[model samples]
Target: MDQVQESYDEFNLNFRIEDTVIVNQTEMEGFNAFFLGNQSTCQQSVVEGVRVLSYKIPATLPLGQFLKKQLYKGEFLSILSNILNQLLYFEDRNMPIKKVLLNTKYMYIELSNLHVQLIYMPIEKEFTDCNVCEFVQNFISKIRFADMQCVNCVDQILHYLDSRLMFSLREFYTFIIELQKEDILKDDIDLGEGETTVLQQMSYNNITPYLVRSRTNALIPIEKTEFLVGKSSECDYQIPDNRKVSRKHCSFRISNGECYIRDENSTNHTYVNGKMIQPGFDVMLKNDDYIRMGDEEFKYWVR
Candidate 1:
């Protein structure tokens, strides 16, 4: 019965689109011809190669009026489907959507229930994997208020939504872009026919830990064998303003190309990715891991 139920559940699950669309020989040939023809033009002007699409839908049309119109709901759904499909297509191709603008004619969509306009610009890059819809959804989910203003500027929209969200989004986007660049650099350096690059070998030999301070946006390279962290001035990495931080909070060190952090028997203790670690016990550090010392938080990056 359990196995049967599991099978039924699996059958009912709506899977996310993950695979790229397969093109036929004719489609491929046409794409090649188009690419070759436009190569010169695209090289000359980058903006000309970018595609921008926009759609407007009456979201606030009264339910009664919409029902009376008969095909309003269908039309609305169709437009939304097209937008989603375009986003998914770009995502599959690893293309960055340059911009996505959402507007409701200078009125809040929740208040007016009137209309929604979506403007999207998709720009193809040699290597980019940004899902515009996912970013929008993630950003929207962080909005504290149900009522949102119809704003043209993405930064303005975020400002109206939440400041914390804006800061977090900026940091996250930067981190992702940096990671992508690192991956691209690694590929360029390492990719060859049966040849291992020196950079690739060095990556395995060395462990470089980086501490990204949230408040100051300061990036500190961890080169020493042991780095002390605390609120006290005596500590290596001092957070004097942070009252929650103990005098001698914690310490981190790199050993055999692996980074480890050990709690230093502090008042508030040390945490890695939210879970508190045992005092004096060393925890192995991973790339892009979050570390919390008392009330302060730091993003750890190992390169």
Candidate 2:
């Protein structure tokens, strides 16, 4: 049984080692830097009186579990593109490429956005024997395509990888982009608004959106792409002296140039217009929309 403790910001995925020796903060931080996703921060703690190594997770499914659901061409490309992109990221920076966990059990994915998360141990020089070539081959062997009548970019990549002994990250990425063209852009996929509250994709890249507090008439700028709001000091927007507000209330995030809000399972909940939004879910905000966090209200402005 894998025991994970959930905090407001992130959940801790703990691994109990057989050594029984407590993992210090240094080792925990090193291990968690590889817990790739929205919440990359690391912390060390004890759970159930046992010494364990823990890492932050923002609720993603293991790649193996996620694959069990109906797989589409768009989703298939998204998953592969993300993994290849991660390899590219590591390669371009000249970072150690072995830190990327190649196995499906270690890899995670956010189904909503089709974003991939990889779990690796940065501290270990020899974490596993898995390498880029081995992973690529395993990935190819993992799944059988539904249709083989027509060749696609995916088939092309499999053929490309098979033909070459030396794998080049940039070359692989370039080939994927060239083959798919527009399909390579994962954001273009229609995440049906009814099922998921996807934020509005910015039409006018010229205009930047902002917010105005209704009470003080203060102008608030979006400083970060993911703007966290709450009464906690850790939040980007720290609301003070508000008993109705939770420490980590909600967040406004700009994904792929579009903006949206998510209720962070706060006690009072978040309201757009008049109705309260579901916790841990997204709600798209438009220009002139009123957002209420507890009693604090702000008018979203796009101009």
Candidate 3:
């Protein structure tokens, strides 16, 4: 097995709890208010539900003070509440819940919409045995879901939770890297000598350049092969106020769904995070990389 897969397996085996209680659809009605209507009412139901569920936990299991310290310090309660609110929102909106699995350490909510599954694990050593009720109460009270359509609801919730949940961002970044590696391997195996020779030209033709403006925070989706960035009126991305900017600053080219920036040999030059790229040479841009032309700065991102 590859290192990534091996690490993933190890993480699951060591940190994950095996047993889970699957909540039935018929039993979902009691929590309708929690999902569909009033926030206060929904929160109350969640608190009560967690208390009942806690009864199943083995009292003989050793309780450590360290665990309690971790729970209170981190955003475990907040994360749990956000997840429950999202699940309830899904349930109330007629979004099918394929399964709701509750374990001692985590909750997995599976939705029929896109077959998306959200796993929420509380921070280790954070919850004291005596603090479960308080945790639940805090979690429920903090939940405030905005009214949004079910289509992108899961993604929106996951995006919000990504910032709060520990290990989530790292896991997601690792998954993306694995996917990119697999894509490269597949490309290498499937290409013929003649086809491979033309691959770069063909791939360049198929690319779409997507960028985010740092100052305005606007998304610029580029469908063209080449995009010009400068102060000139003809440029695709114009920086008008920056006097240090040249008339034609830099050029961004889309190749194989990837973006590359090349300095147009402007007076002030172009840089990626303070590192100046030699004129006429392309610098491949990655997500969250800062691109600077003269004194003006922009952040590069892929959608």
The most accurate candidate by lDDT is: 2
lDDT by candidate, in order shown: 0.46, 0.64, 0.44
- Please identify which of the two predictions, 1 or 3, would achieve the higher lDDT against the true structure: 1
Pairs of colliding residues, candidate 3: 34-42, 67-125, 67-126, 70-126, 71-126
| Model 1, TM vs. native | 0.34
Descending-TM-score candidate ranking: 2, 1, 3
Backbone clash count, each prediction separately: 2, 0, 5
lDDT for each residue of candidate 1 in 196-224, tens digit (9 for 90 to 100)? 64422111123357889877888878777
Q: Could you tell me which residue pairs clash in candidate 2?
A: none
Better of 2 and 3 by lDDT: 2
What pairs collide in candidate 1? Answer: 60-113, 60-114
lDDT-sorted candidate list, best first: 2, 1, 3
RMSD of 3: 20.1
Sequence-dependent TM-score of model 3: 0.33
Q: What's the lDDT of the predicted structure labeled candidate 1?
A: 0.46
For residues 166-245, write the lDDT of model 2, one tens digit per residue: 34456666665554454444446666665544333222123356778888898887756788888999998788878888
Better model by TM-score: candidate 2 vs candidate 3 = 2
Q: In model 3, what is the error at residue 178, expressed in angstroms?
A: 17
Model 2's alpha-carbon lDDT is: 0.64
Which regions of candidate 2 deviate over 4 angstroms?
1-11, 17-40, 48-50, 92-95, 144-151, 182-303
